[model samples]
Target: MKVGLIGFGKAGKAVANVILQSNEYSLEWVLRQSTILEHRHVPEFLGIDSKEPGLIFSTSSIEIEELLSKHPVDIIIDFSSSNGIYSYGKAAASRKIIIISAISHYDEDEKQFLSELSSKTIVFWSPNISLGVNYLMFAAKLLKKIAPWVDIEIIEEHFKGKPGVSGTAIKLAKELDLEETEISSIRAGGIVSKHEIIFGFPYQTVRLIHEAISREAFGNGVLFVADNLADKKEGFYTFEDLLSPYFTN
Candidate 1:
């Protein structure tokens, strides 16, 4: 499978490294919003050994359709901002390319746009794509179902300077019947990722925790989504939708 990446930030670089190391996927091109590091080969820049072109470019360097036409890819893994999809989504869907977005958050309009695109091609979006985090969410939901009266709260910790509350925590809050205000967030140091769901019972408490020690966790998630959705039919799929089948009891 040929792949195109849509962001070049720290996390994006880590994801690119994962693709370079994967024998099943070829990194074809990367598009970033900034002009820095424009026109660099992804493998040479990351010091990986692959013959794939994997070139990098600024979004402004070329039109979105032209870029897709010149370097076609089977999938476009997006670690870019929410609006980044606005640039290439329709164009890629028109070409029947699958999209997996790990963008942290998207408003209602963006959700609608993605839903519409799914009619043409597979569209997979996850607020938090770390497989472990998604697993944590599923486990928490199960515990809640088993004991609906138990009180649940979510806690998330990330590196400092995060601009908003953790979207995963917010989703957890919704699942466990808590408000966004009830989800706690700690932004300090260089914490890769941490989420804990505390279920308080009358006699005791159960704590379910997932901590990501590296950004490569998300890269593995990219691979998981790729493997599962490779031959899936055109539709809008959530991380939970794809991950749920593997959670068979």
Candidate 2:
């Protein structure tokens, strides 16, 4: 698959590295906010060995239509800001391009826009796109369904400087029908990301945890989504939709 990426921030760069190393993807280009690294190749920028074009372009330098025309890709994976979708989503939909977004948070209106956009082209969005985290949520939800009375508390930990509660933790709480107050967060050190769910029983406590050792987990999740969405029709999809089949009663 030929993949185009948006945003060259920390997460985007990590995802690009994974794409460059994967046998399943050919990174065609990257678009970001600045011109500092304009036209630089991903491999050269990251000091990795790969043969993909991996060209960098500034949004200010070219329009989305021109980029799509110049670099036709099989899919576009976005690890950019929550508002990044606004820029390229409609244009990509016009061309029936597939978009996989790993944006962490979106308001109701932004979400509705994506849901509507899916009518034109396939749109996959996941705040916590890690396979492990989604699986943890899936399993946690099942456990709650089978044992609804089990007391549940979610704990999320991140590195210093992360504002607000963890989005994944909030999603998990919502999935389990727990209040936002049921979530706890801790920020310290250089922790990449960590989420733990503790199910309390009268005599025992079962803990399910998913920790991202590195941002590459998101990259792997994208790879997984790309492989699965390859044969699906146009629609709005989530990580859970892609992962539910793997969990059976």
Candidate 3:
């Protein structure tokens, strides 16, 4: 499979490295606005030889369309902000290319735009793509069934530079049919990522936590979703879908 990457941020770079190390997928193109003035040397930043074949680098949608026309990819992995979703989503949908997006904090307009785009092509969207985080969502469902009377709350902490509440916490709350206000967001230190689900009962308390020690955890989950969704039909999917097998077992 051939793959295109959008955004060269921390998560994008980590996902690209994982793709580069795999023989199953070819890293074809990378789209980013930050490299428009970098003399077309995007591969250099990715530690790849500049002369590598089938690797097109561009900073705009026009260039991306031209490159896709000449060298089409099977999928495009997006780690960009919500603002770029409509443009990138429409571009990929027009080409019938699958999109795996890990972007978070989308406004209502952006969310609706993406939902419409999914009608044209497969869109696998997940804010928190870590398997453990998705598994936490699965666990939340079970808890809701087994302990319906318990009060639940989510606490998420991330690096100081991170913005908005943790998507994982929001997802967990949504899955459990709880209010978003039940989540607490913390930003401090250099914490990679940590989420705790507290279940309080009249007599005892239970807690479930998942801590991301490194970016590789997220990268692995992205690759896993990409590989699983590569052959899937055109539709919308999520990381929780990837955890179905575990729950059935």
Model 3 backbone overlap count = 0
Using lDDT as the yardstick, the better of models 1 and 2 is 2
The Cα RMSD in angstroms, rounded to one decimal, for candidate 3 relative to the true structure is 2.5
On residues 78-192, what C-alpha lDDT tens digit does candidate 3 reach at each position?
8878887765677789888988888867778977887888888988888888778778777878987998988988999999989878877887888878898888999999898
Residue-wise lDDT of candidate 2 within 1-249, one digit each (tens)? 889999998889989999999987999999999998998999999999998999999999999999999899889998888899999999999889999999888989889999989999999999888899999988898899889999999999999998888888889989999999989999999898999999999999999999999999989999999999989999999988888777653
Which residue pairs overlap in candidate 1's backbone?
Answer: none
Off by over 4 Å in 1: none
Work out the TM-score per prediction.
Answer: 0.97, 0.97, 0.89
lDDT sort, best first: 2, 1, 3
Residue 200 error for model 3, in Å? 1.7
Evaluate candidate 2 by giving its C-alpha RMSD to the native, one decimal: 1.1
Question: Candidate 2: misplaced stretches above 4 Å?
Answer: none
Between 2 and 3, whose lDDT is larger? 2
Candidate 3 residue pairs in clash (backbone atoms < 3 Å)? none
lDDT tens string, model 1, 77-183?
99999888899899989999999999989999999999999999999999888898888888888999999998887889999998799888888888778889888
Per-residue lDDT for 125 in model 1?
Answer: 95
